[model samples]
Target chain A: MKAAAAARIMPALVWAAAALALWQSGAWLLQQRGVALASSKLPYPYLVAVALFRNAGSLLAEAAVTLLNACEGFLLGAAAGVALALFMSLSATMERIAAPYAVASQMVPILGLAPIVYAIFRDENTARVLIAGYISFFPVALHTLRGLQSVRQEDRDLLHVLACGRAASYRVLRLPAALPGMFTGLKAAAPLAVTGAILVELMGAQRGIGVLMLRHLYYGPTHAALFWCTVLLAAALGIAAYGITAALENTLLPWSRTSGRRQGRGLR
Target chain B: MSMPYSTSSARSGKEASGKVEAERASGVSEHVAVLVTVEATAEGALKGDGEAGAADAARQYGAADPTAEAEAGVELGAAAGAEVGAEASDASAAADDRNRTRTSPKAAPAEKGRFMQQGTAAWALPLGAGLALAAIWQAGLIHAVLGLAAYQLPLPSAIFRAAADNAGLLFRSAGYTLLEAAAGIAAGTLLGWLAAAMAAAMPRWGSGALLLAASLGAVPIVALAPIMNLWLGDGLASRAAVAAAATLAPMAIGSYRGLTSADSASMDLMNVLGAGAVPAFFKLRLPSSLPAMLTAFKISTAGGLIAAMVSEFFYSSRGLGYLLSNSVKIARMPLGWACIGAAAAAGIGMYMLVQAAERRLLLWHPEFRRRLS
Candidate 1:
């Protein structure tokens, strides 16, 4: 247990070490190239860390806006996904009909759609949420559909033999079996929703981490350390999002976690 | 030839998702030789109802067969567990998994044409829906309903006209973007594979490295766009770099899973035979990894395109994203729509291309073989 804990901590150390090495090498390369002017544009890792610590409050505020947008979108998308999955599962024909569209929806670039959606909604937060919801829903829908269909024939037979109605069978048997699958969908959606939120924020958003990152970038030549610090915060949020869902899955669906193990539910 | 255990002569109407479920249950990959062996054993279990050697399948997946766990290291143990469950369930529907690939999805869309009393009618449903959707947009129904202007939802005809008028330019831009995507994916995939391979050799730090890389992938592309632009400048290199960065994580994660899927029993045998790690990798690990690698490639196709387009949002003078964003900025809604159309077509085109290649290349594997039979 202790070893595993230490092992868990090692990646961060390695990542930090890597960052330092890259910074030194980059600094060295710039010096060799006589690009002293450009050297200030790529800050040392420590400087970025200091900058991050200094601006933590503003960054946290921005993150709150982005997270809220993503969370609302996540719920909306997950609900839509569940509804679609339930609707599709009742009829194999619907599942088939909707499958291609699901694939096509995924195929359409959400980045391009973000601007168009922004134009339509004209509300920054709504547009960001819309794109987040669009991206988040796909994984959930596919996984939920997979879970619903994964009901064993014999288990389904037992429900039939018990004279269980379609709704009852779905509620009692199918949903239980699909919980793990749904969790898989949720986990995949977390980071994706954040990415979507950020992408949409780029189009036009007065607030949010996306805007902050772009703002950092726009002023990067002057504030290189601040930009890197913002990037680090975004990375931390993604990791946090991933960790949260994974933790939730472990806590909520222990049975599915143990039993299905791989069931390969993640799409992204 | 690997045993065709799933070649159940009885192809009937029991078109369940048994196969898809099984594959999905397993890590959505496994066209390599090792999976072929697994399928063979499972096939025997189903065909003879346990008369065939279940021991073989059992042994292959046992603690000794280290390759069973050779997949995305993070999910490797889970995948192995899932495979065992799938193996149990798949024995009954081994034939179904194959059969569905060959048939079901293809017949789905036409269902809404009528009552879908027959499966074949399902094909037209999606196509019809798309055409009808196009018709609605063309008729200004969405514009009227949504209270939107012509600029927001350009008519299909106007977009088509723009496409035709600038067909040559659109085509050229698409080719340029596609080339950049292809180059990026190729470079990224290679780098990812190498990283995964290096990591696979050292189970401790390697997996962590991979995890870090993957999490880095979750960093917003919008954030990376400007930085990448600053670093690589406004050349094709910047766009390609963005695409590469975007695609690298998936490839690394996938290939790591593939590379590590080396069977320990085989490795033991190689040890006895005095074969070096290099020889064993070439003989055993590489073939087993082909499925995961292919799966990764298939996934990267559309993603790579999206990455390229997103990167184009920042800098560079070419590609569909540049055109789309530029046209939209200039209020040439039709032209922007045309760019969106070309970009979507390119993305879909690449996705289909990769899928087709997977089917073609892995034809001998049960997943693809079911379609052929």
Candidate 2:
């Protein structure tokens, strides 16, 4: 099993190394071609690495701001989503009326509301939290409901014959069954929440990596490495969000590790 | 555990504690046996009997019927209806409550698989919900709670008026954004499918590519937007590139999973038949992958539009994102809201179009083939 796992990941590691080498050489080639903004367009990987080290403190601080807001919004949205899912699970009528609207709303370009939300709140923190929460809501709600509903009729019947009431049935069977689904939703929503926070930051937030990103971009080619660093930090934040959720899944539901791993792949 | 179960069951008012006590004493061992069998069956079901499991789940939850009906009218009434034309505000919440009450009694019968009887009529509830939501916004309740003035969060009337006023410009901008979205989705899906095919064919190097694509999907569209703008220049191409990059990962991942997940039975049969990789892929894998590919396409459709719009938020002269940002900068809340409305319409329309195509293409697939009762 270990060997198979290593085989699966070995090529990806090799690909990462090849991609890094290609990036540096490609930047060099563009410079040789005398392309305008060549370095800015694709800065050398090492220069960006140096900038990353130099700005590590400030970047991490800004990222913390974004990450903190994202976490708050994620928890808020997750609670709301779970509540709604539970509400819908109470009656098929509620699900009938609500699920379509939930699915339809997701079809809309939700991130487009960042600017409007920012304008309305006129406070960066509020806007960031609101947008992140809103972004995370539907997936969590939908997936949680799907999970809750996935409890088999046989299990329900067993509990029923055992004369267990609804709450007991839920506590023993439904919630446990739903845990994997909830994690799937959380994993999907985590990065999106981060993205939503950064987007709000871009909409003229007071602080955060996004603000620094925009600031550095306006400063032009000289600040290109720092700009790239901010971008990388933003990407890292997204990955961190996902990683944290996956780790939570691992710790909380050890039995589901194999299935959860499979679902995690499907999620990407 | 037994004490709580007995008390809870007694409170449920279905049966008395004496009958519950009798059943509990007799059924405990049977319940353990049931659990054992359930675990075994669940493992078996997970192996390859997904359709059976889904059917069982749908039957249990009574979700299959209404879900089918909902999918048909979801784009029409749920999203576009909320935004297009709404004026009145009074008693909207009450109306919504009334709609809910009316639907529940009917929903009971519909759960028995009578949803087809209502057919197109099933949409009325969702439509009402949309209009009610719109009316609530028009009522300034949202503004009241947010403590924002009219200029900050425009009422539905103002938004509708703005949309009507700038009908020509909004439509044109929507078209431009839609063009970018469509082009990006097409190009990205094609590229992603090719990548998936490569990954399936060459497990060593191609899996790495798939991982790369997945990581790319995690990269914020905001970050990708500027880079693409720099590389491709701030034009239709740049936004489209961003959209393409945003969409590429899901398609690659989804289709790769699909291609590689062909049943071992079928694979062995192909091997016995001495079918080469290309032939096997074309005859078996490609057809099998349609569902996942279409699913990816649907997701990419939404992602593409968002990427195009968000990219436009940074550097663009036209498109809904530019219009939205520009309107907000000028404190034209109504106009910004109108842009959101247009984008919502476009998004819903494109989604419906893709869904219709999915239904058409996947008619042979078991999930779609099972007629909704």
Candidate 3:
């Protein structure tokens, strides 16, 4: 297994090394062609790295704000979705009443409502979070509803035979059964929350990663490298959030390991 | 489990012959077992199946007596008469409720399944809320709200009027935007799929190229737009190029995964059959990857529109995105909203088109069949 892993890793490592060499030589070739075009505004990768290091503090602060908003929105939306799923599960009438609204919410682009919510809320961070939350909530709700619904008949029968109350039945059967679906929703929504936060920030926010990117765009040259850096930072943040969600799924839903392994097999 | 045996004994006289009938039925048990296993596995993921089953059962029970003139009349009326339909549906539902309770003492699973049906039905509420909100805005409630704060959010009526009046221009611009989006998506999907194919075929150099594509994909549209604008000039071409660049990485990654991720057992079987790479890809890999490709296509469709809009924000003079930006600058809030609406409609239309195409192409896929059934 170790040997197989090493063999698999070898190709990727070689490819990376080759690409880096090519990139460096390409940069050198561009310099040979003309220093003006090569080094102007957006410099080579090395120069951008240097600029990123220099302005790390301010950029990191901005990134932190955006991260906070994304996290806040993801949590709130996920909780609300779970609550709504539970409520709908409690009664057929309530589920019927809520179904159309949920579909409409998912279909309509939440960005369209961002301006209105921002106008109403006034506070930039809060409004951004609200928009993110709104954007992120639907998937969670849909998935949780799915999860709640997926509780097996046999399990429910066992619970009934055990004379379990509603709360106990939910604790033992529904919640555990729903965990995989809920986590799937959470994983899907994580990157979307970041995207939503950025969209709100772009629409009208005083500070955050989106604001920083826009500012860099408008300012030009002086902040050109910084702009690319900010974008890279945002991408990294999205990837990180995705990783964290995956990690959480593994930690919180151990039973999903079997399904996850199957999925992984399918991937390979 | 005990109830089945008890019930069988209780009706022994009728059921003795019924046993003979049931044994004959059990002769087809293999087929039934396969169906039940499939249903059970499906039900594991999709709780909606139970309601759908109930709906099917209702339909069956209602339609069972084809020669019963009054029942047939009622059945026909159910389609055309809402009241009749509602009453019949209710009766069928009640029957289902009793059937469920009797057959499964633990009604929780079936009840929860009904929750999904209820959720789908509840879609009406949000539609109503949206309509009511629109009506309120039209009735000057929005103006009143804005007036309190001294802000100038355009009234819903005004926006509607603007949308109606500029319908032709909006449609034309929408067409142009849609064309660019479609063209960009096609180009991106082709390039991405080719890259994925090349990567999969030759993993030696493909990994690095894949990484480069991903990095390029990660580059924000705002940053990429200026470069593309420089390369293609401030025309629709630039915007299209931006959209293509934005969409490519996702498709590549998705397609690569779909194409190369064949089951080893399947791959081994193909190998044993002496299948060539091309045949293996077409027969084994391609079919297996259809769902992933569709997912990527859907993602790219949305991404392409966004890219076109963002690109147009910087550079073009035509298209809905240009109209939106121009309106924002001129403070024609209603017109801006109208443009936004038009763009959204176009985006949704594109998404629906892809979804429809997916249904046609992947009819055999479990997800597609599950949705349809």
- Please compute DockQ, using alpha carbons, for every candidate against the native two-chain complex: 0.21, 0.22, 0.12
**Tens-place lDDT digits, model 2, residues A1-268:** 6776677678878988999999989999999999999989999999999999988999999999999999999998888888889888887667757766665566545555775677676788988898888778876786677568767667888999999998999899988887876776776678778888888888778898889998999999999999999998988888788878877887788786323354333223
- Scored against the true structure, residue A222 in model 3 reaches a CA lDDT of 69
Q: Sorted by lDDT, highest first, which candidate order results?
A: 2, 1, 3
Please list the residue runs of candidate 3 whose C-alpha ends up more than 4 Å from where it truly belongs after superposition: A1-42, A77-115, A134-189, A250-268, B1-130, B136-152, B194-219, B249-278
- Error at B343, model 3, angstroms: 1.8
Off by over 4 Å in 1: A82-92, A143-185, A255-268, B1-123, B197-201, B254-296, B361-373
State the lDDT of candidate 1 residue by residue for A1-268, as single tens digits. 6665666567657866886798878866876787745645466666777888998899999988888898888888989988888888887668757866776677677876877787787788888888888878877886677577767777888999999999899889999987866776676567778888878877668998878888767764677778787777777777677677777776677565322124322212
Residues B1-373 of candidate 2 have per-residue lDDT tens digits of: 1123222322342223223333333323322222212221232222122222222222333444644423322221223122211111111211222222223323332232233234323566667777898888888888888788887677889889999999999999999999998899888888888888888888777867876776677688999998998889888999988888878876886687568657779999999999999899999998887865775676677778888998898799999989988887788878888888888788878877987898778788653453221
State which docking tier applies to candidate 1: incorrect
Estimate the TM-score of every prediction. 0.71, 0.73, 0.66
Model 3, residue B118: C-alpha shift (Å)? 15
- The CAPRI category of model 2 is incorrect
Candidate 3, RMSD to the unseen true structure: 12.1
Task: Give candidate 1's error at residue A20 in angstroms.
Answer: 2.7
